[model samples]
Target: MRSVAAVLVVLGAAGATGALAQTPAPASPVPALDERVVVTGTAAPVSAGAVGRTLAIVTADDLQRLPVASVTDALRLLPGVWVRQRGPFGSQTDISIRGASFGQTLVLIDGVRVNDPQTGHHNGDLPVALEDIARIELLAGAGSSLHGADAVGGVINIITRREASAPTARLAAGQYDLVQGAVAWRPATMGVFQGASASVDRSSGFAPARDFVHQQVRADFRFGRTTLAVSHLDKDFGAAGYYGPAPSQEWTTQTLVAARHQRPLTGAWSVTGDAWYRTHGDEFLYDPRVLGARANEHRTHVVGGGLRVGGRLSSSLRLTTGVEATGDWLRSWSLGDREEARVSGFGELEARVGRLLLYPSARVDAYTTFGSAFSPSLAVALPVRPRVKWRASVGKAFRVPTFTERFYTDPNHRANEALRPEQGWTADTGLDTYLGGTWVATVTGFVRRERDVIDWVRPDATVRWRTENIRDVRSHGFEAFARGQAGPLALGAQYTFTRVETDRLAGLSKYVDDYAPHGVGGDVSLALPWRLSTAARLEHRRPYGREAWTTVDLRVSRPIRRVTAFVEMANVGDAQYQEIRGVAMPGRWARAGITVK
Candidate 1:
């Protein structure tokens, strides 16, 4: 499972040598930024330019042009986001934003929650295939005012395509005997459209217990105002240093089915409703050869639904209200069988006066076992100039401990049933402006004050780690990004700095303190003559109180008739680094592929 990253550094540089000198092509159309209406930040359909919060949108074109293999790969390029990966290609990953814990970030598909109830470690286990995705919208702040629990840091929403385009088939092979094949098909674009995608990927182990095999299947149906989708993900990967001391093996499967529809009434009134059901199963073997090494097995099922009504009452006022309910059931070997149910109600009002926009929203949630809480937020956006906009938001967010954090017991860790729900207040203000007619630059400062922060702590090396509400913690950060597209060159860059302060404690904390204190990244794509082009991504991450490391990935591709051929190098610098402590990651990987459309 080894990759040849360092050996191919010259290959990437050679592709871009004379590519940008020959000709200067025309850039894209008028909208330097996207005009698509986003739904993650608000109940109303708000355009990217009008959003009052820090939001980043990765469109379909960006997905195809980037040096990435999966949706997670594309997400790593944005600002205020951090991805801690245990496996190289396909495996468990934890996503955090603006210094929040993994469990604090919310993951959703078409506005339906998909966060695992057992643990946040599995939150990255998305069921939908990459080919089925249309775009990914990320909101990098508290979103509990409209969405329910587990939205402390921000929200990630995956939007699927509604209409059909061209069918695609792709095949690729790389080092470590890695093999991949994917196919996407969508029939008709007008009435009653349907789409489906399937993909299979496998690789030999980079090290002991490091091999992985992943598969995904998804189908979607759209007719009139109704949309339906079903997806499943299966994964078998080496847990290795992911959990305890021993090299572990784990297998997981996730399936989700959802349905949504909307009805438009007279005089700017509408109603929308959605329902979803998901099931996940996981089995782990700490070590099959060792006697009493301890193994864990778990299964979880989630059922959720929501109804929303209201719309534009006039040109100046828009109102939306909704009710949501969800149930979670878990069965585990060491965590014991547990279940919980929650119901929530929310309302939002968007008022517009002249060039100013105001948004106010509130939600109340009641849980059978976790009691009730109210979350309220307000956001404002003002156009200081024709090309400049000022935006700011303030809100309260909370997260109830996952079942694993409260009751799961393992050889290396213990749970605490006395843990309390974590809560925090979030606020941010930023300015978005058009620079030099081609660049869209944004700079923002944000902070969060959290109470009863949760973590697994052990006083020393002898005792097992246990869950505890480690008093108070304050996290603050600054984020900035500049993106521009002119002629044949498309450029993007982002910088982030975060500092986490915690009350003095006896033991070391597992995740609350283990964070990337600083990050800098950028993406560059250049179109060359004769359909030959190259793209590269650079990432520099500095772990808290540790040496920093940098990595880059490059891809070069060209088209021939209906097919496109490409080659890629991951971790181009061959930097040896670990996203998590005690875990070792491979250096320098190369792959090649062709796509037929």
Candidate 2:
């Protein structure tokens, strides 16, 4: 309690100083929205103001200003999104959107799908370092029509840095015996742009068997209209009590090699293509200290590619078409060996008429194992006024059962091969309003109706849990957000409410029912004198079936010539809370670091 009060006092003082030192900019007579380009919400790049769906854009500047330890931490600034981490510094993380399960979200890097084919548990294992990112885009709600499977809830795209820049290095150390170092360089020569980065982070255990080591390497080259990137990530962490209540330890390594090409043809016409390969290896020990104890080893490989073309049909009409193919194979001692392949094609049209915009898209996917499925979506946007817009969308999405949910067998769990794909429909409507040139506010309401929702269930406590498909389930939610900037200060706030409806069946066990019913989050950033800056964040959550909790984080930094020093404090209240059940989070930990250019 005292710690929380102290943090509040410090923030209050900083706010006062900021207000006195800087004044707000004069408001424009007729404010106009910035013409920001976004590619994630549609088949072709479009202005953010024209997109009919809810989207959040996090820029490189935002990443540098936030005191986040990992890419997932920075995502919390957006509403209707939840990021759960078991350890610090990208050790282990899970992301969910709008009350959906973790597996329903899709992750992409440089426009290539990175979601693991075996399971969504490893989707957050991004291979690129923070310094290598150019920007991140989050599109909420079903995106299956634009991106193939695993996009039931939303999509997150992490774009890599490509601009020419000087080389920079960073080093940091802090509590829990943490040590980290990174270097990034981007240079253009002979009509070619080249970028490369490497980083490593390690920390001693805060508790027994809670240590971790993370390493990454990335390289990208661009010549003319073609670009190629390759990245590798290695992560080894003590996963004690991470899965269920067992004292488990695990190690994992991932490799990604991808290439992309784009060429502009005639007026308003372009072609793009991408190919990538990924491999992941996992080893788990039920008890590290007990020799010959139960253990599992698995290795999975995924290869995929896609080609797309877009052109204008008329002055206000555009069309895009694409084809994609993906293959997944797994070799494991416990789950045996298996393979599956899929082919998909999609098309979309964007038409504008006066003050109204319309987008319609459809996709057909043929899977070797599960036959075929078709998904479609329609979205519309209407301008209520010059500064106000209303948007609505409806879409269908699906998810195939993962290998771990089908064939794995253990003492405490069993898999079912008869499980079918989960299918659902999502609908949403929202309004976006711009107040002057510095303030923006949005409100959105959404509902999801699903059939054959997958879940693990057991008849009794003494029996092992088995995978099954539920008959029907429904979820609805709403989110509100506001953000503004004034001189050297920036402020943002978000709130969300969700409700789930399902039939109560006897002897049915449930997981992922731990989503928060209500959540409120806010952030503040101020630039003080002498190249000094400060940021603070607060998050409050009220779960459906668990205790509610609030957390606060603060950071301060100063830049001096070629060197910058910064310090961050997390869980300033020293609150004891568990994001994942039975996994205790750290409290009141402090870290400081320096960067040189």
How well does each candidate superpose onto the true structure, as a TM-score? 0.92, 0.93
Residue ranges of candidate 1 with Cα displaced over 4 Å: 1-34, 189-193, 291-294, 435-439
lDDT of 1 by residue, 1-597 (tens): 001212122232233233323423223111233356889989877777677778877767766877888667867866888888899764888889988899999998888888898999888888766677777888887799978889999999988877667899989999888898899988785445488899988898778889999999998877678888889999999888787666789999999999999999787898999999999999999876798766688999999899999888788789999999999999987888999999999999988755557788999999998899899887776555445666777788999999989997767789999888898878777777876545778888877888988999999979999999886878888999887778889888999999988998887788898888899999999999999989999999999977899999999999999999999999999999988777888898899999999
Question: What is candidate 2's lDDT per residue for 1-597, written digit by digit as tens?
Answer: 223323433443343334324533223211255357788989999887788778877777766776776777777877788887787676777788888888888888877888876677788888988898787888898899998888888889888877788899989888999888999999766355488899998888777778989999988877567787888989888888887666678788889998888888899899998888999988888786787786788889999889999999998799999999999999999889999999999999998765567899999999999999899987776555557667777788888888988887788889999889989888877777877755778988887877887888888889888988875768888999987778888888999998877767667555546588899999888999988999998989887788998999888999989998999888899888888777887877888999888
Candidate lDDT values, in order: 0.83, 0.81
List the lowest-lDDT window of 10 residues for candidate 2.
22-31
Task: Extract clashing residue pairs from model 1.
Answer: 5-588
Cα RMSD (Å) per model? 9.5, 8.6
Give the 10-residue window scoring lowest on summed lDDT in candidate 1. Answer: 1-10
Runs of candidate 2 exceeding 4 Å displacement: 1-31, 190-193, 436-438
